[model samples]
Target: MKNPIAERITDFIKNYHPFSELSYNQILQVANTCKVIYLDKNEILFKIHDEIHDSFYVVATGAIGLSITSDSDDVLIDKCDEGDVLGLRPFFAKDNYLMTAKAREETILYAIPIADFKPLALQTPAVLDFLLQSFASNTRNPYDKTHKGKLISENVIYDDHNNEIQYYQPISYSTDPITAAVNDIVQHVAQIMSNRRIGSIIVQENQLPIGIITDKDLRSKIATGLYPISVTLDQIMTTPVITVPENLSIAEAQMMMLKYNVGHLCVTKDGTNQSEITGVISEHDVVVSQANNPGVLLKKIKRAHNIVDLKLVRDKMTDLIQHSIDKNIPISHICSIIGELNNAITKRVIDFAIEKIGTPPPSKFVWLDLGSQGRKEQLLLTDQDSAIIFDDVATENHENTKHYFLHLAKIITKKLNKIGYEYCPADMMASNPFWCRSLSDWNSQIRKWIQNPGDKGILMTTIFFDYHCIYGDENLANALTETINNEIENNELFLAFLGIDALKNPPPLGFFRQFLVESDGEHKDTFDIKARALMPLIDAARILSLHMGINKNTNTSYRFAKLAEIEPQNALIYEACNEAFLELLKFRTEEGLRNNSNGRYLDLSNLSKLDKVKLKNDFQPISEIQEVIKNRFQLTYFT
Candidate 1:
């Protein structure tokens, strides 16, 4: 049934343009599906590149800021007050939002569903013209002078003494004169390449490029005698060539080559290889195009022999993180790249630490990364939380084995500290005897935690359960995970306790929809984003994954995705949780980068009205998930 509130919203919006042209019944139908959303000051309605909503918003009271983020700078594009329709362009363009809409003050919005309003738009020329004119002007309101003649998310050039980033420059490639038919013999192709003094040549079919044969291909295939000189060019050519349009940008070509692990790209009339050949751009071409890329950074990391060199590479990675965020890359993709790089750094540390310890490990031991590192969610430098579990030893060697690992852990942790990872304040490090133990000892401790479910046990479970073996014996980590999941499956009370713990931090929205900021202390009137916002999602995923017998997928997003697969009935809810967690992570990382601190406590006053609202809106999933946990675990019956 349509709410009575829709009728009131219909009365309100009918006075506005587009809506003004519609009849009472026509506007009422649009309002029937309208959602009335309340925004606390600084709440975000949508972000740049976010999927367009089925509905667009009209601010009934208060103000909204339509802004763009460039190089981490938030630029206000427009300040929308009463009767200002926001985010309507995405609906017309059938694309994601190009700018973010955030509440500038405590606001009430009538969200008119485009599914119903679209037909009305077609029927009314004035309404359509109003939208078309406003969109063409790059302004939300045609008559308003505050926003005009500039794109949302305008590209800002940055040039400093230390670094210069070129946004998008087209790649230059060698065009014409290098081509061979498929029937051309290998010897003939090689002779033609030598005559031209080029390293590669295109093999063609019809008038279009079909494949490429490079120096490496000839070396591996002909020099190694895998193919004879008499063989046709088709035999040695790398088929299904990677192609890009002639207008490919230097950055795009570089990233594409790195992503595909190719030394050369076939430039074609169209982007596909079936089109006529235009030119070829090689890896060397891409390298000459740019100096600061992940490829260069990764190469530096891999070649570094000392911790000092690694530290320099690590510093550059911080800049890369900022660049990635500023460019609006997908958070998931950034997380994977950063996580892989972090794992590489840690692996090198382990190798060096083992060498420094002066002896190969007495037995097989797995290095466990706890907390954020384990989940692959960490972006900025944080405390080290790790453990080591070795194979069980004979009674006589037990003490000695433990001592050996402890010494190695100390060296590794110290090196990591020097590289920017601080020591865990709680001593949750491998150097701690309690954490570095034999496989049997580790298994026993985990059993006790699940069997006895106390406050300490739950706390320990929260930290340790998200472990991933960054470097070491995978079987050992797998076995422990199996045992932990098995133990939890048989224990219903333990899941209930975990569920209760997950609800410890209620959704951070108050009765008036204001942020429930920290009342006092160093972060007075600040939002505890980590504790109040992030932890609830993390804790819920861990507990639910345990209950469902899903083991080893420690990432919050991954856990929710797995949950969605296991329980399709609740897939939408789980999927929402995944999206919320990622968005929150991005929010925290950006805040941290801006303040140069762990992005945990956000000063509520510093947020724009739209940002405040966006933060509050994310809390909806937390409340919904907590309710799911309460019902599933029957938590209402708990004391």
Candidate 2:
């Protein structure tokens, strides 16, 4: 007898190829033997090593994940959604399934019998080729080592050997650097070098190499009185500057630096200095090209004099972050190194701004980083949130003091914007008069927020509480933090309100185990990774840390680690949360780098099976931690 659901099943299959290639009668015949299966979210349809099912399944609704489990470790391989097919193990020899197929969300699937479909696939060349292509593209069989298989060995994709070869291409050099005429006066040459900070100013005439005047040459000759300061550069400059071609490799550049015992190399259009000076490559540039060590990066940041120079350094920082993740470096060390570089960049911007202003600060003050920067966990370039708190001024001179600091902050932020640190969209920068205030005004504001603790007050508190002294008097920032801490200790209700705010997003998994993706807005159908995944963890960490009277730590991961130590019973859970947070952060950063956005919105359809599993694993701890918070604080009463 014909199955009643056969026509509907064929209709669904006919929409997707190579089923669409089949005649309607053929598709209907195949669908008659199909089984309709419903899977609850997370329910496993097939496990690793299980015998191949005779039927291949097509997703009719929701999503499915294919994963591999070995030695108690599970890795997701691929994900399939509506119209995507799974369970093709029967296509090959009678081998066991290489991966487990599971329902990512509550899913309805149509299982088409291989007996009915194989003859059609074999008869049609296009249909057979399409199936092969689909199998290869699917995330399943990631470990398959055969020719152009879906699963290449994991080592090839993620291990150090593969990443080193893939990410570290040879560095490029600038050719035909600007050169000075040999007979140029000593003072003029000195001015040029100081302006450009080029260690050696190439002396050329008619685009021919002549000599070079480096900082060393000036200090050794003119400064030491070996040669009069009024002498021409030709008198003191080293003759016959070493020249290289534009295509110098990092290895070759380093070799030249060693061979000549020189700090700078002049690159010409041709290999010889007879050609025009194209560019200069310094030893410092070579070092920056090689690695992102903190000492090396810090030195590079300090030497950056302009926005263009700083942007280059910032790009290197991104490379550093990717390298750290690829190498499996400790997250704590990565954060510290990145934090130091970020702080150094800001400090350089301030120093440059001060030089531009051509005046000393009117009074002492502290520059406060108000958000992730303050927390010291900002690995990616996100929004800039900062404020200025100047030293207390005389009542009559208060307005003048505030104005001076605001002007300074404006200059600094402008430079920062040029260097790729986007201005805070909400205008939460030091340039704002409300943010650039004297110490007394800041204190008053904190007091009001602490006493009131309304929605706006809570929002303000969240930003301000993370304040780290980026520049200026550390003591001033410390004093402010002490004041806020004292207020929080006094007002227990404020803690409750913070707790209420922390629980706003809750865990992302719904009762049916489906991801609570954003329903509307610019992020519609995409996961709000920040507010939904990362922020809840951050908020929970902050509230718990505050309740424990811990103020020294600001990073979410560190807070969880400290909490684990303080509360040993919940140590396992907190440690899990910390690990999950790091994984999620790394995932978000990689996604952001790929998509060229903030990495907050994730398209659920694009997640690989392995990525889906890792993400889902993260959710388990999130759900568990929220439960702990609920039980410990009795947060349900407030909610």
Candidate 3:
């Protein structure tokens, strides 16, 4: 017997995900069991710690607000409008409610029974996967025994400034950077550069960097007839000068240039445009900074003709990382050099891909590195995760534009695979259609995730939000980040949902304060250093940085340090998190080098007493930071 109300509810439920993945007959059958309920504004549907209901909910009309209790008030974490679903967490876990659901205004909801939905999901793989992803709050469950995120390794080099020891040491730059006024003619600036034997000149206004002109500019803009020699230097100069701090190391300087796709970096008093210029380092300056060092490796990467050349350079980089670890150089320093070298390889690969395609990109685009690579913490050769963001196109040209970029990404990813950065297991690479999108489309996609974060959306945001521009126009990445931060500003509740995910992993120790080793599996006695020790801190840093609107950095340690400065009251805890992360990172890198494995799982039998103590000490910070997050996001009611 078909009830009219149940039939009407079926029409609405059939449109959204998990439901959309189901057949019409299955949907109507589930809808027949739904219990429609109405509520006035500010009425409670469920409270935190309430017993799990047999039925999850879908909004039939009006809206529902989801919130977590904090101190004395309810903090809204997400809003469910018409057709949006809520209470799906019950489908995956037989636990109490972690949030309160109430009507924001007069609302109507169709409570869809999980008992009815679960059997259907089990029969339909697509439906099961959607529910699983949403329940887990990530692409896959982080704590799953089978899903140990590991990658195969071959090995990669970085020559230091003439010697490896001097690589990260502070670099020397020409303090007397040649400068010109905005009103100076290009011919006059070129004349000054020629007389001074300098290849570059900065254009200044009131002792502030406005732009820069170099020999390349002279050749491209004047000699090639792009601009007249008599035109002002401003007419030919590259604007928005990329600035670096006075203490930049050779590797750091090189990375900045690669990051911004520039040849020269203006060193300033305060490392910003608001400060006075102190010095400058050019591409030639970097190449000659060290004859047989990382600069050499960088030059080789830049000058490589094909994939084979890049592969050789990459193999050498592995030796460099091993040597750095053997020498006991700080893990942070090793990361800067290795991360930059990795970027150099990626930049060169992108260059080769473009050449191989036999055509230039239709418009500007940016290549974004996600996850560990985005954080510059990819010390070992692991899975490569990336995405592409191109400038928006017209409706008519969208498909063709997307097709062209997809072809380019396929070539780029294929070459990267040959070079030893194996394909990401989950296929989270630029080559995938979902990963490669126009800027406007990406914005829309991100906004959708931000608005309806739930569990799955939070997972996607955590992965994608910490993006670093590996190649192409950095402005595109910046524009995308700006949009993300802006949307987050309006939807403050997204961070609370993110916080819920952050608290998913509990303290790393067991009841007896022992190292919590795996009890059952192939590696039964081994410890998952990544999931238990590392991810807790990483998640805390990410949530805090987002809450504070710190979008400029992606590094875990760097984020913790920044949070420390901003909240001096919590400095000790923040500093502890940073130190623990670096120590743990160094330990993992060494383990990987020793075993020739991904270094994620560590056997307890191999650890020395001192090593065990050090590892245990680092675990304390995990508890401290989790408490900070629980209190900060008002997630006290959560755990």
Candidate 4:
């Protein structure tokens, strides 16, 4: 006898595909004939070459492994988790099952009758097309050879309609640009441009543009009578001009101009200026197309009347980050630009919050960004880790001043949370009264952590040491950093303690060079690339740099390079660490862009052999640096 739950299953399925085209009564009829099957972990649902069953299965819970068999050996093709449909061979052809289906874990599946589903497939063209495409992409019909021309058929079926997907259309630019030869006299070029009323002319060699002579060049060089008008174009022209492809978008063109601080972009055939000049995109052209230039974005931030407008600007910032990455812009430069923008957004949020409170800040205060944001290395959206520190007030006004800053921190943090920077899960944010303190209180807290030197104190230092002033007075942050450095100079034990903490997580590799994946958790079996690999290097750099009494440098790579220069004996090792850190960051950024996540956890199973090798190479520096830390700090005796 079939379960009564089958009718409910049919109702759910009917809302989604070929089943939707079926008559309500007919769907119920099919559902009533379906069977509900349960399997424990590692149990086989069906084997290859077995006679096809009367129905296919939809995973109700847990996961199933769909695999193909070759010479009696089964190779897993894909893991079908919840909502995945599997085993649909009988409807198309009367053949034995080509693959083996096994339960990846304890699972419940709903099996629908093929006979009843066939009528719906015939009635719905969308359903039939989707089924055919899914089968072609997922099944073992490598030589089935049908549906080869239907590009995006599988995408149409699987892509979620509601997700915000960015459109990647080619940029528009001015075609048929003015050009000249390198040997051409400036006077002659000026005559041609003046006759045509063009402001600039590109100078080329063998059809490849090499330089540009603009109106500014003529005014600054010739009109000022500094350079003779008879001088060759090369004498007055700016060589190695910025070049962009014809397809650059308005947003990209604007970013490029702002990034390089240039007014003209030479449009080349392939964006390299190695080929003939095809067009030009001037600063004016981009400004005309884009209503939200940097100036506009900045003004909007200033004039933002509410959190809603600020949210819109923050969303635009996310788009700009993606654009920067796609344009192959330097990640460091991108981080600085976005950091300033993010800081501006925070400032605006603070202003809006203060306005809403109907009171100005009771005292001068600074908002400090801790951890990655402090280091200016935050490339992806991560948790907010910050603190608020105000000037010490008179005893009479101390409590009242603290209360005002706390309220302000709460408002600012709330707006930040709404803008996609998730609240720190660990409560390590400015909103916490413990974090929102006066300058005197912050100094006292740092002294206690430095003197005590316990696990909690070390952890606090790890978070606080990365502090970069995101908003408010820089002098306050500088004073705090200087006080800490002065204190650290005398506290050799504290530096050793920090070094030991840095060595806690060894390189994530086992004896046989296999990845040391997490044994248990929600992310069980996944490699924690951030914690195990990246953090070790970051922690080491901070500890070593602080010990060297170096200040004002927050970047890990720059810190390591500085360390290398100061300590020539350790130069090679430090240089290797710097390179490895950059490589890992680049890898993580690429992965994050691909999967749309923090890119902290990596799926080792899906990594290419080349990437695995590259990742393993980073472990060498980790091991070497840890040894250096242990030896230099004499942590062996302490451990």
Candidate 5:
């Protein structure tokens, strides 16, 4: 007689790994002895230091959270969802469990008896190898080479084959740095560099780095007749060398190169120029370490002569974002790096646009990146929202001046779209007649929005208020920002209106912690992450930050952090909102990369239970912060 339950178990396990590697008859035999167990939400299956059980478990449905308890908190490092295997520690070792396993939601698991599977595993080479590899993966530190493959106190670090983890790993710079003294002949140093096939050599005195010389310096100073090759290194080498401490990660190294516009960095004992030089990181070395990384892509962006060239670079940036997200690099750091690249891309597009028109601007102007680009929070290539502010012109020349800038903006925006950034659907872009205005016109425009913020005014403030000058005339942009802030000071009602808007989208979670998903339309049954989760935090931050006259911090997370400092009584709430915003931003970026869309709408049913739990954990701050906004603005009675 056939045991239908055992046969069903074999069918499910066969679809997954290790079990998938086994023969059907073999799996059915192991499954016949298995027992089924069900758990309520947050129910613990096994815990740290608990005696090993006779059976290892497989997640049949829902999700399981595997975590390590430290002195401070429990860190959920890994999740096992449908078909995911856990509780394999008992099969590898007779020792107690090192990590705790708990059901993140209502869950059903299949407990496969070790006695029944061990004999089957020994007979199958594939199954035996799979067990050995899985057992070797449990460790406290994934990067630690010595402790690389052993169970340590039972927390597991999932192995990554894509080299994503290298983003944070310490870069291996050349410790035995080749150096030259200030008195060394330029010709002599050049000979040494060429002999070693290296691009740069440090200039030092008293064993401390003073300056550096690279191939560029030689070509310009010697070959171009700026200086003679017979001169001493002191007269030719670049002084005040850029210095960084040892163990700088690859991401940081790339950012440092971009920030300083240098091809090499000297590594000192201490992180300053005063310390002795220990190692050197050249552009060649960094490029070799991570091919197709930020340094390479940024260089490609700068050198691009055609629209197609920049498009290819933008596509590579997508790959970079994907890698950064996978490696779990701090979202803030990733934002800053990507923001710089985007800024560079936009600036290059503007340069090409100006050149295409074959003429310079009629007046000094500033290209403004409004909305997410302005906040430096744009990780994905979504819609572009921008504005333009040119210098005020004489009455007779106003129309002509505005026309020139508008044409320039049109060219820039079109090229941006051709590269990757989609044109904003609502036409809230710099090319619009309303957005392309003189500095004086913008001042008047912002004043009207602030002084009389009706529905239209309120909506405009949200779209246009956050501004970052990407190219040209920084002073023009600053003058406009000053006016917006000043007008906001006298308009308490505008703040109230903005506050009312902030509460429009309450925290997304409904009663019993179910996601409040869309009820109709093409996005029905999907969660509007942007509208329900991100906007509440963004709107509240914008209103509060403007009220406090905090002009420098435009990024939402930084705004909340600044709010925490100034409003100490509400520090905890503000701080939590900051963390919450970062988490949500990271979550959205991850989803966007996975589905190749904006990642604002999420299919609730497709998400694993553990992911839903993670998302819900971040929603609490949104509720508490909204309450703070409501009471402070007194919006309860405002009509």
Candidate 6:
């Protein structure tokens, strides 16, 4: 039977060349056996040096980017839009793909089998001519001269070992770096950095780069009283700075930075400290060169002046997350990068809110991210759960101080809402008077929750205990964490309630080892992966850490890692829990990207046999962890 979908794809591609050379009947015959592939943005169709697929591709819609990974720099060479042919080089050359073909946007591709197309090409003179011309010119489309050399541009260079050599094109740098003399006072160098809105200033002696002083140097030295403001640049600056040649490529610069664990590099006449400084390249420069890299997205988030700019950057982050998943990057690594980016975005939103309020907080305040965000495991966009803790004011001026912060919170949450973070459904946000409070008030609220241990109190305890300070005073956040740990140290009742909550959803598998899917709800017949699988691990980590007087480690994986270190008796189980948590997170993130939803509810029917098995294997750790939590807290009495 003829597939209607393949016919529709054929109808679309038949309007474009070399398919255009065939009759409707002939094209339909070819399309019947052709495969249709749907790709999310940033998804790779074929990677460099990957085995040649049996087919070549035509973009039916959206765009495909042909990129070359030269010296760790994935340089986008050409963009193939609708009707554009790609991956054909493999067909003509009988070798592995030289360049990667990635979806630049949500794309649909018609994968025409090369075996079937070859016969049609021989019969159709026009089709034969198009293929020969394209192959001869080393171009995807011979008619388009605009990207003539792009396909074969330094993508196939070979070394003596016959290994493909990655090309490293020189990158642009800031030639005029902000500099200060070696004899300049710390105060003066600080002034230069502030005026230029830069983080580091190169220290020079006789027009040669000598040392470097960054914001971090000042924070750790001057602010910490290790060095005074009157100290000379020669005293405070880091000596024998790392240097690269002026003609350094983006990939090489990134390598040097990573090798040294430094953020800034001096571009010199020669690639050594002995050479004169010609320019400067920072990690930011390397990041900006790659549009889809997480660092670039983070930099963009920081520079975003408005919510619209932030929205665009958030969109890019989505693509970055998708790309990371497609490459099978470790889930923990992906979480850390996305988590940092998310926090940065939240902090930027707060900065914008402060700007809109036309004034900074009247007193010192710290922004608190609650629940999943506090744990730093948020991969997909979801509701906002945040609060503010300002310094205590005089009894007479308490309401006025509260009003200032509440107003500030209102602005921030609204801005975040506009940028795609939905308002907390329970009103557990800064905009709520109950959540936005003075430091003492927050401390008291937590005390009440810990001391009382009621259902609502337990709920609040769960939400607030994982609180991470997104911005503001670190001392204030540390003090709050200290207070919470002190309150829970002797509270056996509180630990019991938390343990009871942790076991609410038992392991996802039933006695027969069948998935215990939701029987009925809006997500009928679907597996509640988040509520059942992920939350059990999160709850166990939190309660177990609380019992051991561990605070401030909100992330489940991090908590488990810490647990493993401290509890070597059960270290294997803790490590197993950590791996299970990561795998579940990866599964949920991939599902979320695939369905464009929260990935909370997973359709069991949609999963492959391998996916089902992988998910099933993770359940044992959840069961084991819950058993440990139960015995530790003596939760049998509570239930």
Tell me how candidate 1 scores on lDDT: 0.79
- Quote the positional error of residue 67 for candidate 2 in Å: 36
Model 2: residue 311 alpha-carbon error in angstroms: 1.6
For all predictions, the C-alpha RMSD in Å is 18.8, 22.5, 26.3, 28.1, 22.4, 24.9
CA displacement after TM-score superposition, residue 509 of candidate 3 (Å): 1.0
> What does the lDDT read for residue 537 in candidate 3?
90
Clashes of each: 17, 14, 11, 2, 1, 0
lDDT for each residue of candidate 2 in 1-639, tens digit (9 for 90 to 100): 666699898878898767877899989989888899999999999986688999998889998887654212344546777877778768744877667789999999998888889999999876765565345334232222332223221211111211111122233554436577866789887887788766777888887777777888999888898988778878898877878766454555665677568878888877577887887888777866666544456677888878788888888888877765665555555665677678889998999888988988888998988788888777878888999989997889888888888899999998888888889999999999989987788889999998999999999998888877878998888788878888888476787788788888877887887888988887888888888888888888888887788787587777898899899999999999999998888778777767877778888788998898899788777777777777767777876
TM-score-based ranking, best first?
A: 1, 5, 4, 6, 2, 3
Looking at model 3, how many pairs of residues clash?
11
- Which of the predicted structures, 1 or 2, would earn the higher TM-score when compared with the native? 1
lDDT of 4 by residue, 1-639 (tens): 655686677767666445565677767877787788999999998986688998988787899987653112243546776656778778776967656789999999889778867777777775665565345345222122442221111111101122111222224456988899888999899999889877788888988989999989999999999999899998989989888755565545655676567788899877787877899788767655443333356667878888888888877766666655665545544555455566677888888788889988887889988888777677777889999989888999999999898888898899889987889999999989999988888999999999899999999998898877766788888888878998898687898889889999999889888899999987799888899999999999999888887667577876897899899999999999988987787677767767878888888787899999999999999999988899988897765
Q: Write the per-residue lDDT of candidate 1 for residues 489-580, one digit (tens) a residue.
A: 76888888888999899898878887888888888988889999999999999888888877746778878988998999989889888888
Tens digit per residue, CA lDDT, model 6, 385-498: 998888988899899889998988898898888888889889999899999988899899989989998889999989888888889986888878888988888788888888
The CA lDDT of each predicted structure is: 0.79, 0.76, 0.79, 0.76, 0.81, 0.80
Query: What's the TM-score of every candidate structure?
Result: 0.59, 0.57, 0.56, 0.57, 0.58, 0.57
Model 4 C-alpha lDDT versus the unseen true structure: 0.76
- Pairs with steric clashes in candidate 5: 98-154
Candidate number that wins on lDDT, 1 or 6 = 6
Error of 3 at 635 (Å): 0.4
Candidate 4: clashing pairs of residues: 171-247, 171-248
Any runs in candidate 4 off by more than 4 Å, and if so which?
1-299
Over 4 Å off, model 2: 1-292
Worst 10 residues of 5 by lDDT: 157-166
